[model samples]
Target: MSTIYDVAKEAGCAPSSVSKFITKHGYVSNKLGNKITAAMAKLDYHYNGLARNLSTKTNNRIGVIVPFLDHPYFQGLVNAIILEASKISKEVVILPTAYNANREQQYLQELEHNMVSSLIITSHSLPYTKIYPYQRFGKIVFCENSNHQQTRCVFNNRKEIFEKLFTTLKQKEITNFGFMFIRNPQDSKTTKETFEAFKKIFNHYPQPERIIYNCRTAEDGKNGYLKLKRTIPNLQIVLSESDISAAGAYQARGNSDTLIIGQGNQLVSKLLRFTSIDQHLDETGILALKLATEATSTMKEKVNFDIIWR
Candidate 1:
């Protein structure tokens, strides 16, 4: 492998001059730059980005910390972030933690070590106490709601959206509805907001049997629909966590006249011709990257959302 020293020897220039030319950190004369370029072409040399980043204390890479990769919701968000980063000439590194606290902490430590310029945490198991200390290392942006006032986030305004959704549903005389979740109500603020919104509009909390937990895939949604059917035979509607899950319910409800509402307005929702709430994931991702790269205030930015009834 050709190193910087090899390029320097071939170019007959100081290694520092070669470094300056390659990293563009300091000025190098046009003649020295041309020589280094020729030397690199002859030696087929490739500079180490990690080493350069360490020396310059700068990075063009942004890390996105996600909890799960199998779910389409996260997959869509990642794709949006990657596309947005590419437009700005930035690199994206996806770090999956599977909701593991230790793994999340390790990825956060990467920021502390300057391995990543900034991090966009889609979800995490670590508390703010452990994660906040590393803010001194780099910008830490959240893709979901945050309790702390000091943190920066770009999230869907689920509370406002849910309130409007339930109000609309109630006006349509839709009652006896159930909802699915990837996490328990206590663990996710979104789920809690959903519950509150349902209670406010329906004038009562949904029965425990109507709530489905640990739902991430189409299979989970199919099973949840079947389970709810057994309990509440007259199930009128099921609000799915994602369009992927909603597709399952759409398939399982074969001849039933039940309404299947989904979130995220994913491709499946369009193809399956089901109703869904479009959370504007693309916009959220774009804004999250902007927040990480630019000087943004430490406040929660809510992505606009709308319902698509089919």
Candidate 2:
């Protein structure tokens, strides 16, 4: 209920002085500033953020649009972004789309309406062309590899990591392999890069039947493992895009000889003692926020990955 005018009245100072103190737009004497601060504390007064944003055409909130919040990879990125944003007094708004194009488009309206200062899209259902048009409203940063050259992005270096993984498998002479994906590689540039790298290292694409789709949980992994066993019969190795799913695959191996490689290098991977890829997601999140807040050009930064052999 207390406004700047009330604070001014309580402090016996001009309203302009209180306004300057709140906005830090003009100089206010330290002595008067103390009085204004004390008055605000006594009255429990808070500035109207919306009003300020309307006047300045700026917001202190950043929107992060992701497909799934529960996934460990995205969870890490969201947590990192939230922590880093807090240090700079910025608020992070999580927008989960569930890979719904309509929901993703609705979230984009926040940028159009200036509700958020910028958006960091970790994943999406719509293509880059549709998302690219919204950048004119505010800065749009992609956390995955995007085909748009004009959009800013910060992503993990997945291609190099995939090459290293396949090379290691080849060194072991493991030819019959399979892949597990959280989403279809056909729709995801990052996962597509993994397949491209695999093809380059290996002589052929992975068997269509060997690759599993929609593997999010351990149960999905278990089912995927069963399917792979039925189809490949002699599957040498299986690479899962997430550690949770990989853990499931490991459990379902049931004394089988298939080597399981997981992604995310999360707790499940470490506890289970399996090789996993550390995508350096925390760094990607920090860099993505940095680009969303600071970058003016079409900047693309790639965070490195490490293959943690357990």
Candidate 3:
């Protein structure tokens, strides 16, 4: 491989001059700089990013940790973060962990190693206690509602929104409810809060008939509908974690009076003509990136949500 020495020799200058021009650390005459640039182009030289980052103690890259990219909610979040990052000439590295704690820890290790400047955790399986130790590496921001004192969090009032949804259903005279969630019990704070809110509102109903757990995809939603139909014969309302799942349930029900409410007002929800919670996930993504870059005091920023009634 052609080295800086080769480029310097080709440009008829010293290696220090070539290094100064490439790293922009010191002054190099325009004439010599042009020669070095021409020589580098002739040799098809590429700068070693790892070596540069190691020497500078910085990188123009941000690491985002998400559960998965298949869901529209996550896609929207990632896209917004990427868009915002691009405006500042930064790049995002998405690390999908599929709710694996060990994989999340691996990404934390990457942060510690200075592979990226900071980390935006959209969703993580690791507990806050385990993740807190890594703050020494770089800025770690949570994109979900959290009470952790170690990191800044940007999230919506999901519990309040769920209460509003339940109240809306009650006002519509709908009692028999079926709730679909993406995460397992105790796996996520949102899931736990949502279920608790559901229980609080529907305390009179049987627990088994009211929940459809692990509804991560559209297929799961369809199958969950089938199970709910067989079990809860008089089911009047269905709420799903994502619009994709709600679309599946809407397909299974096929033009019924059953009220379907979807979380994440995605395109599928609009096409399916169902009411959905617009959590402004794009805004969440932007805020997450901002917090990760700005390094504010450990704080929580709550974004409002709206019900996109069809």
Best model number under TM-score:
3
Better of 1 and 3 by TM-score: 3
After superposition, which runs of candidate 1 have C-alpha atoms over 4 Å from their true positions? Answer: 1-3, 29-31, 38-45
102: Cα error in model 1, Å: 1.0
lDDT of each: 0.88, 0.88, 0.85
In candidate 1, what are the lDDT values of residues 6-87, reduced to their tens digit? 9999999899999889878799999889999999999999998898787678999999999988887788889999999999
Off by over 4 Å in 2: 1-18, 27-47, 295-298
Candidate 1 local Cα displacement, residue 197, angstroms: 1.5
Candidate 2 clashing pairs, residues 3+ apart or interchain: none
Clash tally, candidates in order: 0, 0, 0
| TM-score sort, best first | 3, 1, 2
lDDT of 2 by residue, 1-310 (tens): 8888999999999999999999988999999999999999999999987778867888889999999877888999999999999999999999999999999999999888888999999988898888899999998999876756777988677898889888987987987888889777778776788888999998677767878998989999999988988888788888998999999999999988789999899998999899999988889988999999974564898889999987
Q: Give lDDT tens digits, candidate 3, residues 30-67.
A: 99999999999999887787788877889888999999
Off by over 4 Å in 3: 204-206, 295-298
TM-score attained by model 3: 0.93
